[model samples]
Target: MRLGLVLSEAGSGLRRNFSMVVSIVLVTFVSLTFVGVAALMQLQIGQMKGFWYDKAQVAVYLCNDAVQNSNCPSAATTDEIAAVKTALSSAPVKTFVKSFRFEDHQLAYTNFKKQFKGNPVADYVTPDILNEAFWVNLNDPNQSAVISEAISGMPGVDAVTDQRRLLDQIFAVLNTASITAATIAALMLVAAALLISTTIRLSAFSRRREIGIMRLVGASNRFIQTPFILEGVLASLIGSVLAAAATIGIVQFFIQGYLQTAQRDINFVTISEAIVVVPILIGAGVVLAAVSANVAISRYLRV
Candidate 1:
């Protein structure tokens, strides 16, 4: 009987402040959607790092006739190439290197042609113009800096390039995007909380006479507050469900339908990741609404 009365009062409050309830729902929906997106972005970044870092290699490029710089004053001689080969097999650096393959001029030119197959620049390139390189795969990708420092400034080495450096730039951009989304979500959530509080205050004010009557009848504060809190919780619950649906749509249409097909090489966040985020969003919304409503009602009742 008490539960039914509490539920009935809660429904009455919601209907009385219909516009405010709708506002809370919309605000929470947008805020939780941003939260879900931010989470998925971080997940996508982690997946990319795990996939790319494992395959990244350190490439030590040798001096060629076409390259004339302080690092490569002249084309690398056979003796210089042999010196580089000996250093690779030696200690300190050798232990970190899992395996190394030397690509000669002809092989390098062949790869260049294939990479830039239809490009006009491929026509101007030849075997003699390309630098021979040693592609070293390290046991730990983080040890790339150690290998780079060891091989750099050698007689035949023009440059030591770690593929992870390029990957870092990509990851940096993704991190920035994630931070931006999280920031927006936080601001929206604050707005939603304030809206919920305002809605609760209005509902309490409208029923001040009824509250007084209940107080005279020896009703407890818990009984008076339950209905208002339920009102906030119900509104937030609706918003959370809408946000979950939107999140699923993004994963299905934007991520899987478009990104997976468009960028076949990259792995995107799937529906499973969205499913994981849904519960989190719903919990956050419910908790925020409940707390905001409780605080607002407590303050109103005290006065």
Candidate 2:
């Protein structure tokens, strides 16, 4: 019941079990770091999906004179390209097509070169060999297949590609990575719980004789158990704080500092999103530690 005594006991227990305390802290930090990473990964995926889907376009490629495609009987003429544009702008197909932009062979080649600037193969291609295309923005991204089908087999079209399909594949990979992180986080949490329980058990057994003396002095189980539980809670709280700091560093350095500059076109989870997860991880760590400690004390210390 005495606050000073309870705090003194907690301090002594932490000092006596310094190594075990450090282990608990490190384990909790790592486990919660994985948790945060998994969350951020999901956030990243969601942000990307929203960003890309909003700008989804179907590319209807025109035939290149130098290439033979089943969809292209011969090189598409300017008139055919014009006809495709007219179709996209008019009623039958226009309802699905929000708008369209034409990329000539030179523009397509320029983009390709920019995309693969360092690749050896890029230098070998010429604009004449590249196909022009209509980048068609759809009223609804989910209707990409409909737009692609409508444009396919048209006189000037060589291929009708849906950007949404490509984006889906990319998102699928991100989702898998998120799942992997969550799996690792779950496994590490199990390990952390075991370690926390072990730490509490060790702390109790080391002070068993003292605990017996306290019992003889009419101390209740709650009073006897408070310090040990507090020890675990404090260690876990420390670890959680460290984990939050690490998470912030990752978002700031790797994501904002590096990736944002390196991949300007890609959208990612903001620093605010990363920060929002910190309290959740901290609360989880505290709860996890408290539960593990209580269970261990009840089992080993008869409390």
Best by TM-score: 2
User: With candidate 1 superimposed using the best TM-score fit, by how many Å does residue 191's alpha carbon deviate from the native?
Assistant: 0.6
- TM-scores, each model vs. reference: 0.92, 0.94
Candidate 1 lDDT for residue 211: 99
- Clash list (residue pairs), candidate 1: none
Runs off by more than 4 Å, candidate 1: 113-129
Supply the global lDDT for candidate 1. 0.93
Cα lDDT, all candidates: 0.93, 0.89
State the lDDT at 257 in candidate 1. Answer: 99
Local accuracy of candidate 2 as per-residue lDDT tens digits, 1-303: 899999999999999999999999999999999998998898888888889899878889889878886767688998998888887877878888888888987899989999999999998999988888899888888888777677787887888898888888988988998999999999999999999999999899899999999999999989988999999999999999999888888999999999999999987677889999999999999999999999999888654
User: For residues 116-172, what per-residue lDDT tens digits would candidate 1 score against the true structure?
Assistant: 989998998889988899999999999888987777899978999999999999899
